[model samples]
Target: MAGDAYEVLLTSTARKDLDKRLRKSPAKKDKVAKAVKRMREFGPTYPSFNTHQEKRTSRADDPTYISYVEHNTHGAWRMYWKYAQDKIVVLYIGPHP
Candidate 1:
């Protein structure tokens, strides 16, 4: 994993969404935790996407173009990351809902 650059950055909105979901349902919270653990172990390799939405306006001006993969857990969570020179940079994690 040398030369690999990975980071997880969660937007405020996404954080709030996850918090809301976790507060609303205990089952969902467990599922979310499990999914995140899996992601940490395996990286963002699930819920592959052929196409992804353009970066949000808040992040549009950023030079890096972040790609996302959607994971279906209790509701749905998104992993925003980028790959460069065999390195995967995980930029965000949060609930899409």
Candidate 2:
């Protein structure tokens, strides 16, 4: 069931990657913002988007599940995240790399 509204966070790595991408492609800022808004409004499992689980476990050291939000753009972008408790912590955001 949908619990209380979940909080979305970005890890340092994610923040760094996003910053770089935004700097290089200012046009992507709006898309990134929309993606984040969707995450907040619909949580990590939004049905409209195809989100996939990541094989690399978690960076938080706890039992974690990794996932991503795919974005269509000139260079395909993805928003990676880790789910735990009531938060979705973004781990990365950039062109598939």
Candidate 3:
């Protein structure tokens, strides 16, 4: 548990997508912000609080996975991330499709 904390960051594409969403809906923006904050504070372990899965890996070198978190007033939202050392790179975020 000592190394549970990780640095959370969004990919450039994810940042652009989030910016677009923030301009369209304030409520949705708030929910996403909260989720992002949780990710930073709790790191990869935060996903355990929601429904999550470790995606199948073809390469042992890659540990990419995804999680479904409850979005405020809406259905579950999906987020993809991969851990590298002490960092959690958030690759994507969007409504389940």
User: Which window of ten consecutive residues has the lowest lDDT sum in model 3?
Assistant: 51-60
Writing each residue's lDDT as its tens digit, candidate 1 over 1-97 gives 2332343445576567667756766556665565555545555544543225445543544323333333454536555554445544444545553
Task: Give per-model TM-scores.
Answer: 0.44, 0.74, 0.69
Model 2 TM-score relative to the real fold:
0.74
- Which candidate gets the maximum TM-score versus the true structure? 2
lDDT of 2: 0.70
RMSD of each: 5.9, 4.2, 4.2
> What digit string (tens of lDDT, one per residue) describes model 3 on residues 12-89?
998898678667665666667777677777755664446355556525578666765554435556677777777878
Clashing pairs in 2: none
lDDT at 91, model 2: 75
- Model 3 residue 5 lDDT? 52
Ranking by lDDT: 2, 3, 1
Q: Can you tell me which runs of candidate 1 are displaced by over 4 Å?
A: 1-5, 46-97
Residue 85, candidate 3: how far off, in angstroms? 2.4
TM-score ranking, high to low? 2, 3, 1
Weakest 10 consecutive residues of candidate 2 by summed lDDT: 63-72
Per-residue lDDT of model 2, residues 1-97, tens digit only: 2443668888988798789879998987887887788788777677745775555664445544433344455567777776656678887787766
Winner on TM-score (1 vs 3)? 3
